[model samples]
Target chain A: SQQGEEDPQALSIQEGENATMNCSYKTSINNLQWYRQNSGRGLVHLILIRSNEREKHSGRLRVTLDTSKKSSSLLITASRAADTASYFCTPGGSGAGSYQLTFGKGTKLSVIP
Target chain B: DVKVTQSSRYLVKRTGEKVFLECVQDMDHENMFWYRQDPGLGLRLIYFSYDVKMKEKGDIPEGYSVSREKKERFSLILESASTNQTSMYLCASRLAAYNEQFFGPGTRLTVL
Candidate 1:
């Protein structure tokens, strides 16, 4: 089942600017994860925010989750040209062994240098 | 490094040919997943296995089947490749209790 849905299907941002992406899910989840995918390739794990945690940060990345709203946001600071990739947010929980992550349609981000 | 390696990065086959995409993980994880990606549609799960010799169908598993004869390897098979099967296929794996799946570089299959 496709549970997560991200907003702003595509985004273009200048290098050094901050990029923000939002994701909304259908049902309750134990955690929400963010991933990055280069063109025609696999996804790289970025960050994961748990249901009990409202906010978390990793280096220049900040993630906030609101269980009430069933939404989450990922903020990237100081974006670079290499940041050009597709960003996907996945909803987790109620799946097999906690490994089933229902992914969203993803937001394609193009960072201009 | 937890590495997930796919057998082929790109493949091309006839419409009626049987196609196989293999994925191997060196981490010996207990879970493996195969997904197909289409433009504007994101990633859709085709199958997943949590143990050897066991497989489960995913959201879109109509023309696909899977094999997990070993814990470190999983294979996705297309009984009869169709043009619609032309897409990027990704393989992922993670520990049984972990949701942080590690993905392979993907196989771009083209059916003509």
Candidate 2:
């Protein structure tokens, strides 16, 4: 079963524009993480926002968590052509001393130059 | 740099054949995971191991088995391959304390 569901299945924008993707999960999570994947490549971890944290930023990536609503969002500021890829949100929870994460169907962002 | 390597970037196999996918990590991370990615469905975890010889099934573990005989290596085995089993296989590892996971280049498997 998929724990997270990302909205805006696909998005297209011009270079330098901002792109935002949202995710909603069903269960309580210890942290929410964002990842990027280029075509034919493995996923790269972008940032992690813990349950206690409301927001986090790294480079041009900003992540906000609303635990009360069981939702999270990733915002990319000034996106570029290089930013065209699939963005995934993973909600992680720990059980019996091990952490388990489930990834949602990603939001495919296309940045046209 | 943390490096995770898979045995092959692409593989073609016949139906009913036993297939093995290998993964190795150089970072000495304690937790390793195997996931399969497909169109629309995204990535689904097949199995994970926290330590040598200790394995646990993930959400979609049917038709898949895993082996973790060594600390640095993890192997996912397909008991008998089928056309439906063809997908991109990804391997990832993370430290016990960290939430970030490092992933290997995926293997695109085609079962004919």
Candidate 3:
């Protein structure tokens, strides 16, 4: 079974519009991270929110994590055509040296210009 | 900048033939992972190595095996190439916790 599952499998919005994608996981994770993939390439890390942090911000990207609900959300404010990509959420363990990051199916966002 | 390099960006192989996908990271990171990306399934981990000669099976490791002969390099091997095995193979290296992962461009494999 997949540890994380993203909601709203596909989303579309015009350029400059805000986009939000949600991910739900079932586990006691030390932290959750967001990543973006353009086309068929490998994913690029976006933001990471630890279990102790509720919300985090980086540039136009904002991420919120609710440990009680085991859910996380990534918000891309004022999206651009280049923001059109597949977004994924991943959970990592607290172990001193945990290597694997369990990934979700991902949400595909289309920013129409 | 840390660079994770994949030997091939695109590859084509015949069914029943053996295939190998190579990934190398220059950061000297101890953790290396291999994943396969599909349209709806996103990225599924195939294998991971935390240290040289160490391997761990991921969720969908059925037809795939991995080898980690050195700290900075990891290899994913397909014992018998099958059409179903065709996918976008990704390699990533991370330090610890939920830290940012440096990813390679990825190898798009097609088994016909």
Look at candidate 3 and tell me the lDDT of residue B75.
Answer: 95
Task: For model 2, report DockQ.
Answer: 0.68
lDDT of 3 by residue, A1-113 (tens): 23578889999999999999999988778888889988655588998888999999999999999999999999999999999898988876766434678787789899999
* Full-model lDDT for every candidate: 0.89, 0.90, 0.87
lDDT of 1 by residue, B1-112 (tens): 8999999999999999999999999998999999999987889999999899988888899999999999999999999999999999999998874468999999999999
Estimate the lDDT of model 2: 0.90
Query: Clashes in model 3: which pairs?
Result: none
* Candidate 3 lDDT by residue in tens digits, B9-111: 9999999999999999998888889999888777888888878998989879999999999898899999999999999999999874357788999999999
Clashing pairs in 1: none
Model 1, A22-85: lDDT tens digits are 9998788878899999965559999988899999999999999999999999999999998899
Better of 1 and 3 by DockQ: 1
Candidate 2: segments with Cα more than 4 A from true spot = none
Best by DockQ: 1
On TM-score, who's better, 2 or 3?
A: 2
> Considering chain A alone, what is the TM-score of candidate 1?
0.91
Give the poorly placed runs of model 3, Cα more than 4 Å off. Answer: none
Q: What is the TM-score of chain B in candidate 1?
A: 0.98
Q: Ten residues in a row with the worst lDDT in model 3 chain B?
A: B94-103
